[model samples]
Target: MSQPELSEDELLQRAGRGDARAFDQLYDRLAPRLFGLLRQMLYDEKEAEEVLQEGFVQLWERAPSFDPERSKAFTWAVMLFRHKAIDRMRMLGRRNRLVDGAVLEQTTLGGSSQAADEALQDAERGEAVRQALNELPKEQRQLIECAFLKGLTHHVIAESFGMPLGTVKTNIRRGLLRLRDLLKGGA
Candidate 1:
């Protein structure tokens, strides 16, 4: 006799790309098996609930990266859910490693934009630059703000702010120096 075949991965992939029906199919395919496995592994109902739900959420979030070549869909979810539950077991040591590895991977993939919408979604890259304005001192930021936002003449700003034009110039230069450091630190 032959076992029936299932398109578990195709459904999960569609779900990962935001199809509601695919998500439902994935839930139908995996939820019962997961609940059973968790029941055998965990004694406390609350612990099982937390671990199972967390595992499910990670499945949804990271589903886009799941590769059928690596493992069967059911086995992958089971392994992930088990590791998630077990992580709560003794996390102090291994938690840091897991977080660090994830951070490293995200760093490498940070610049990948699948669409123009995704790239423009930040739309506030300017505000991000403004926040990084920590690169400049208050005086410099004020000067740049006055010069750029108000369209004030540099000489006029120097006179209104009670400073010589050259000092204003000096602050703008040094402030830009600090901002470079701030943005680098963020990355």
Candidate 2:
């Protein structure tokens, strides 16, 4: 007799109990959609693939904690993958910023006089932004970092930080307004 196709919840339950085949089945069923989502978010095939792999690893480890009452298995999986993609994007952004800063520093220190002048202006703008960020309260700064630097949605930030969704949204709005005022005032 042929085996019946398992529902996602069934597969999840089996996988949660350490059934490798069930986990593989779940991957086979969900990988394409998850990959597509990650690709759209990350805009790089290699990074999407990496995030997908990491997501699966996380799913395997956290499967036992999956709460059907809270969300469907597929939804949970997607959330995990999305979070992983965002994290990878943030890491890449930070790395690129660091590399760019180093190159800018080198050019400023050794390049022609005109290029050095441009780099100095860039440095001053960067310093001003840094000072503005420092002036924010810690919570507001964190909200701004999550929204802008990490490219996370307010809902994701709220969920990850265990804050109310409205609170997250309000903080981001207020933070941006404050940052705008600070920049306008040349603080």
Candidate 3:
């Protein structure tokens, strides 16, 4: 007679007790499906693979804490992979934004200026906006730069700068209002 296959819960229970073989079996059964899910979320093959490895490592460490009352073992594992993939995506997005911002800043700095009257008018408006931005407090200016110029969300900016989300939002709002007032006065 053929040996019966162990169910996921059985495998998880065994693995939780520090059975390496059971854990290996669990990894073999779930890795492909979890990796596929991660790949779909991340949209990059290499990154998906890396996140898969990371997820499994985390699972190995956390297997002892699995609770059947809260979620199935499979669901818990999938959540780990999903969270890892989302974090990777956010990190990549932040990096891309920074690189794009740098490139744009370089392009603007090196741009050739036309001698036309319209070009002069546009330059003057740009200068006014820069002057207004410079007039704001340093903290407000930094928040505005991260939220507006770099296209970061308030939550992301808060995490990056280690500030509270409410504080970041407040600073951005105040900075924009101050900038608007300065522009109106200058005009």
Predicted candidate 2 versus true structure: per-residue lDDT over 46-75, tens digit per residue: 678778888999999999998888999999
- Inter-residue clash pairs, candidate 1: 135-178, 135-179
Return the TM-score for each candidate structure.
0.44, 0.60, 0.58
Candidate 3: pairs in clash: none
Off by over 4 Å in 1: 1-6, 91-187
RMSD per model, one decimal = 21.2, 12.8, 13.5
Clash number for candidate 3: 0
For candidate 3, the per-residue lDDT at 181 reads 94
Per-residue CA lDDT of candidate 3, range 1-187, in tens?
9989998877887888899999999999999999899889987777788789888888888888888888888998988889999998996666455545554455557565634564556556666666676677768977887887678999999999999999999999989999999999942
Q: Write the per-residue lDDT of candidate 1 for residues 32-139, one digit (tens) a residue.
A: 788777767766455576677788889888788879899878878888899987776654234334434444454446666445554444434444455565235557
lDDT for 95 (candidate 2): 45
Clashing pairs in 2: none
Q: RMSD (Cα, Å) of candidate 2?
A: 12.8
Model 3 lDDT-worst window of ten: 95-104
User: How high a TM-score does candidate 2 get?
Assistant: 0.60
Clashes of each: 2, 0, 0
Taken over the whole model, the C-alpha lDDT of each candidate is 0.70, 0.83, 0.81
